[model samples]
Target: MSHAPHSPLPVGHYAYDEVDRTFLKQRVAQFRDQVERRISGALTEEEFKPLRLMNGLYLQLHAYMLRVAIPYGILNSGQMRALAQIAQRYDRDYGHFTTRQNIQFNWIRLEDTPDILALLAHADMHAIQTSGNCIRNVTADQFAGAAADEVLDPRVHAEILRQWSTLHPEFTFLPRKFKIAISGSPQDRVAARFHDIGLMARNGENGRPVFEVYVGGGLGRTPIVGVKLRDDLPEEDLIAYLEAILRVYNEFGRRDNIYKARIKILVQALGVDEFRDRVNAEFVAMDRARYRLDEGIVAAIRARFGVPDFDPAGQAAEKLAQQRKADRAFDFWVRTNTHAHKQPGYVSVTISCKPAGGIPGDVTSSQMNLLADLADQLSFGELRITHLQNVVLGHVRQDKLYGLWQTLEQNGLGTANVGFITDIVACPGLDYCALANARSIPIAQKLSERFASPDLQREIGPMRLNISGCINACGHHHAGHIGILGVDKRGEEAFQITLGGAADQDTVSIGQIIGAAMSEDETVDAIARIIDTYLARRTAGEQFIETCRRLGTAPFKDAAYATA
Candidate 1:
């Protein structure tokens, strides 16, 4: 069957040129042939496995899984609608949004993936490099262009990196999977410091956009915060500098042991200074002009991301105030789920996918359609998927928020608990994943149900609670303020708790294990006890992390290990 070309350009973001379209079409055709060969027994399972994985097809516990890359987490209404259609037509009528800012269809058939990929190509999307030992999807701040405090739009740079890393010959089959994240704002919602490489935008001496580069930060069996490789790097040299770092890692990273294959382990073994020196030496030997980025290319990419038509003098404060006065729930949602926008009278809206007793990031096909409609009506036909497994409508007018919230509430999408305890991050553990040691959704559900009260969550203040089913740390448990890692002990599910971890831009830290493992039932009580201890010992205005720091883990340890 011939694969016909769809639209050459994406709906709202950067338009894909002919080269991009040709690449995706050719990739799909090649994978289709691979699938046919595997099914026909011309290729062995061992041989086909790597090819399938390289194309984002996975053999799960029951069936095959397909992960579609949402580059930079940016999505338009057309793309969202296409995803909804895929969920409805191909698999179950739901898709799980992952912490890596991608979506996974758990029940995808091996025979259906090529067709699914063909559908995605129509939206200028793909699944390339989403799996296997290659550079995965490049993630960035969901609020990249819209945030009020952003120094620059990180998506421009993120898109550049995505193009550079796509099917890169040297790094395609690395020691292990690599991840990179970029953030434009000082407040890092993307958790950049927990990736293999992190880039934060900053203003240089000449007021041009520079980057604060960090290397060797990752989470899995070993969790480490990245060290600053350079305080300031010129924008033109970004690709070359990154090439240097990846080259050093590709050369020296451990290949014998799977667990020690990550770049973080190498950085730790060699020391950050030594690693930096090697990268600098390699960079010095390279031809700078050959790798240097042209300003015109940057300008062309920037042009594709057209500015939103915002009303500068629009008056919406009075309407918002009146709505807040009339409805307390609306007021609470506005306070928790909405954020300041770069444009006046506009705000970014975070729609909490995690409801009480619900799975963390699973959104139904109906909800997806609703989101697409809402995006078209209120959010400039654009939306973003966050690394925290939440959906964001980045350019909603303040006056339209109440109506949007009302519709969301009617459809069970408005939970009014962004950044709250109920807003938990979880992975598809034993329920769907083959790699999981235990179930994570149940634990997340229990926690959300226990802390269902908005008043209680607000009183407790901003806290991050992450759950991982195994040591792979897909849920980012190590970076959470309260990290819960599920493990298999003698074929029984047990949980280990860690405290004082953070993934913030200003204070990135890894949580320390508090004590022995607890049963799932006991784990819930332990968390309650820890929270009670924090409440009892906290000073005025102290958050959970601050209270923990002031009183230390001794108090929490005692509380957690008490009679229960």
Candidate 2:
């Protein structure tokens, strides 16, 4: 698998077929009425909470956290602008893009939620299943359809799943939440191995799409990489495969202990091979093609994701060079922030929401609006939210990089460090999530501060430091080259370290714990020791992983413990 990453198809199992404009308008009215009842006390908070959550509203620490689904990680410029408007009018100054390819507004009020939903509906967007123990937002590689290495657009399958899972009756109340991710590319940019279900698209001998299914992988208290259960499953078996996985989970996943409730535990307890056997038996028992995916349906969904037109006749290449010659800043930005697109005249640009020492995925309302405007003006009316918690302008012409950078810089998004060390993926640890055992934001901030130098990050060459608030692995710490997981030591916070973990195509390795957990203050110091050990032992051009493996963790472990 080398192209890009895939998403969790189960999340997309409930995509309603597009109806006429009249029905679209009618559904909005119905939801609006429900909102009115909830807000006006006609519906109690207890009665409304589930409904609101189903609509992607969460009453969080300071305010309501609204999770808007970017179905299969696809968004048009019109939709992006709609979200920007919601950020500006109803909430605070900005939004947070999430690892699920969703955008969240942290400052929404309860009263304004319906209006927000209404706006999203207008753009054919909603916040359904963003929370609760049901399937979450279906996510795929941000570069899904357009990546050169992709075999087929995984989003098409994601859309299929969304239709199947939406308000599904059988597995809705399973022991705990379920997450799924799929990928079509060999390069695992979407972090499939860390997801509950990871689907890789491969071609069969007949040149048809076949799926490789991975089950039981997760991030929380138990971080286990998913185990592949079935290989070369025919395209028609997608739904049956999903049913089998969920049935096994729903039947045996623990419910008594919340901490032990995830499917990962069930999969682990049964052992990977045994679990696969059980799922296969269940699949065999199901009515063959009972959940058959209709070709017409698949085609209809694909039609919704049509590619934006690119004007090959335009002055693209020459203009790009002129812009580069005119501005060194623009030149550097092009080299770092922009990615080559399959389309000749267009490029994909990453907008870093993680400024130095700032929260990794925070986007202001103003910035969101500007991005929307820019999307319409320069590219197609579309923007994509990435699993890395960054926003991407997918169809930007290389010629417009200068103007885009100029506008983005003013909005605090022009950080010319896409794959640098400072571009960390961290969860909203103890400060926000109830599941978090330790604080993650501060640790991320410290790491950012430690590796803020552009030169240092470049020298390091794509080191990923993922920090989780807890073992639940929301931060994807288990897959980072340098992974940090927070653990609860009695009532205090401690950090556990793992080295050589990687979330890439060639290899999927969970880092080994180099040493025992350390206190918060000592954790950063521990990371420093690890980096120093790597630097000292590196062969020319050797990556952190290569170095770690060559020397093993012994030397780094010794240094960290010696200081302790």
Candidate 3:
């Protein structure tokens, strides 16, 4: 049988044979038994909590949230179709895709979760690592193997990590949740710099794949960018380096306070150079035999992630562009949402999960089915979930873009505002989180309406507006070009604004707050005022960050505080 363009299981990874299949078979049976016990009162909530959470079941504000893992962010149309069915049949008619590359059905019943897991397992997917403090779904660039600027597909490395970290005895119970992100491109769209471990693929002087490693970065009450430990370690040293870092973190990272228990806190307290030295020392003393990379193993892993079957025809993009002249809306989508692919005749199209006033990453069941069908029709049955909280129908031919956009528009999935201000990233705040002080979704929704125009977004020129309900920066507000942090001021919900924040390859500076906090209503208006000020003050062709830096924060700071 011919392989699909983007195979979910890459070549180098272990294939599901009789033995592996039997393990899954037994695991499903075991979970089914656990569910029956819990339902029949043989298991209490406390007893079933850990077991269910391990299988990606969480009781949230409204209902049980079933988180299904998309390991390393790879998915096929059929799996997505199953997800659509799950949402339509059992959930709240929609599912939310999180930054961790997992989808959550927010309205699942406690008794229905096992059936959901079984359904997912049938599709060669599962919800493992969806919760608990163990290593979560390892994420990489959504573009992955298809990015034009990528040096190497980081999914290869991500898959390796996924295999090694799965149910590992040593790192399972860590100080806190651990996140790892990889970027094969220098563009850093995946925001690797803000993760627990950020691995960037680069070529050494020998032109071989080497990794630039960053450690101790995280968000929430304290936001810090990772510090580089090794600039050019060969691919073979990945396991050794990662093991060394994890050992140090597991041993010395804070455990007394859950709030300050992340590796970032330990790294910050110890200092970067000291941390690096500690990691290096641990690496030197470690047993190399247990973790060293085997070329054959790496080769097999590489084969699984092999590129999709794509024709070398060069005229697709041009032909698509020509068709756009006849359809203006399709042309808008082509210009704004379609990204360049390494392969000619193909482009990566972002299926915006953001609809006016809707949640940023929420997709309806019908939308999912349409997307799955659309992916199969246009892109050889492959799709990717982006960290920005959207979907990508990769490998779309230029010629079929118009029809796809028409379909997307009919399904409420078509929004030409890919990088627009309305396309916001927000955390599930007071509504669902135990730690939140304010609501983030309303803030995002209000801000989206405030600057809802595509023309204004274009004029603003690539601005990122991120909001977090509390100090835990799950929304990644610290990295936004214009970051808004929600705080509690005298028991009232208030917001603080920051400038010059970024989460890219060149810089990862945490945004500096300009002044005192404001009420939720005023907060939305204040963001508008800030953007208005930017429009008035920026020099010709200056981006948001450049204008903030060139004119100094005093101007924007004063503008922000003027209403304080």
Candidate 4:
């Protein structure tokens, strides 16, 4: 089938065109046929596994898991409602938001997948490229375009990458799964340094967009920080440059051992200089014209990203200040859950999915409906899924903040914890994932319950605690300031701790292992002891990470293993 003409873009959002729609329909049909063959004994389990995986379906320990991609973490009310419908009808009554800006339904059946995919297609979304050794979802800063400090919207280029990498013939089956992340702001909210490829957009000396490209970063098994390959690549060279990097990787990346298959291993094998030199040679030899993006095409894509019309006369600061004065809870919510917006009188509100003693990234069907309604009425019908496993209404008027907070509070969505320690990023460990060695959610719950007090959390200040069930690093434990990795020691659950890791502010560092693994009970106490060490050692203004960096792991180690 030929490509379809572009349709009109949705107001303040991007909508899939006829071509996109046709593509999804065709893919769903293809998967549906494959499913029939497998069920009829025409194909064996081993033979059909890869086929099912390419369409984002996985056979976990309990049931089939379907991971639906939320490109760049952007969603509208209609799409959100569709997800709610899928959660209610197909799987459980809730969906799990992942750290990769996608949602996975754990109880999916293979028979229901084709229908579910059809439903998603109607909403202009899909589960394609979400699994199986290819470029995964292209993630960007959750606050892209809305943040006050962004140089430009990273989604613009992220979308470009998404389009270019989707089922590209050359990259259909890489040695390992590949991921790419982009950031437009100075702060690295997307954990750019932990992806296979990281791109940071900035203004060049000539006042044009340039990217600082980093390659060979990954977290699974062996975590390594990405190294910069290009300091200032022009906007037009994005595809060509990316093609060069991938070509080099496709040729040299290891395939002999599954553990050493990631591009990071190859990059390490041939130092950064050698890798860069190889990529440069490839770039020099390629037909640049074939990949160079035209200004018209760029502008067309940019136009699809409709900007929200701000109320020019809306003055919300005074009203918000008055609301804060009257209500302490509202005040706390404002301070903790809201972020500064580029547009005056507006703010980006983080709807905390991480309530104390709850599943880290789950939202019920009713909660999803309520959030969709709130987004439509108060947030220009736009919502974003954060990489930190939360939801964001990126365009709420500050004047409506009080009412919005009240509604969210009523629905148990108004937890005043965004950057706090309790705002954890956890993978569906032994509870859902078959690859998991130990449980992650229960540990997160115990930790949150231990430090449920808002006062204590505030005093503790901004902290990131990520938990991964295994070294696969789905929970991004390697990027957290305090990272927890669940391991299996002698067939028993044990948790390993790492300290001083960071993913933001261009200060990317892999965490250092503190000590030997501990049992589930000992793990929580060890965390508390670590906190106590930080509390006792911290200066007046030092954060947990700062204290750890200053004192190294000596004090925390001594405290964690000390006998009472």
Error of 4 at 392 (Å): 0.7
**CA lDDT of each candidate?**
0.89, 0.78, 0.81, 0.89
List candidate 1 stretches off by more than 4 Å.
1-12
Error of 3 at 402 (Å): 2.3
- Per-residue accuracy of model 3 over 295-345 as CA lDDT, tens digit each: 887887777654566766567667776788877767777788888888877
Cand. 1 TM to true fold? 0.97
Per-model TM values vs. the true structure: 0.97, 0.88, 0.94, 0.97
lDDT score for residue 59 of model 4: 94
Worst 10 residues of 4 by lDDT: 1-10
Q: Model 1 Cα displacement at 44 (Å)? A: 1.8
Give the Cα RMSD of candidate 1: 3.7
By summed lDDT, the worst window of 10 consecutive residues in model 3 runs over 8-17
Residue pairs in collision within model 1: none
Query: Model 3: how far is 214 from its true place, Å?
Result: 0.4
In model 4, which residue pairs have backbone atoms overlapping below 3 Å?
A: none
lDDT of 4 by residue, 1-564 (tens): 111122245434566789999999999899999999998999999999999889889999899999999999999889999999999999889999998899999999888989999999999999989998899999988888899989878888888999999999999999999999999875778877788999988889998878889888989889999998897998889999999999998998888999999999999999999999999999999999999988987878888877676665266888899999999988988999999999898889999998889999999989999888887787777889988999999887788888888888889899999999999999999998899999999999999899889999988999999999999988989888899999999999999999889988557788888889998889889989889889988999998888988999889988988852
Tens-digit per-residue lDDT, 341-411, candidate 2: 78787788888888888889877767777776776676555677889888887767667777778888887
Once fitted onto the true fold, the runs of candidate 3 whose alpha carbons sit more than 4 angstroms away are 1-20, 326-328, 489-492, 561-564
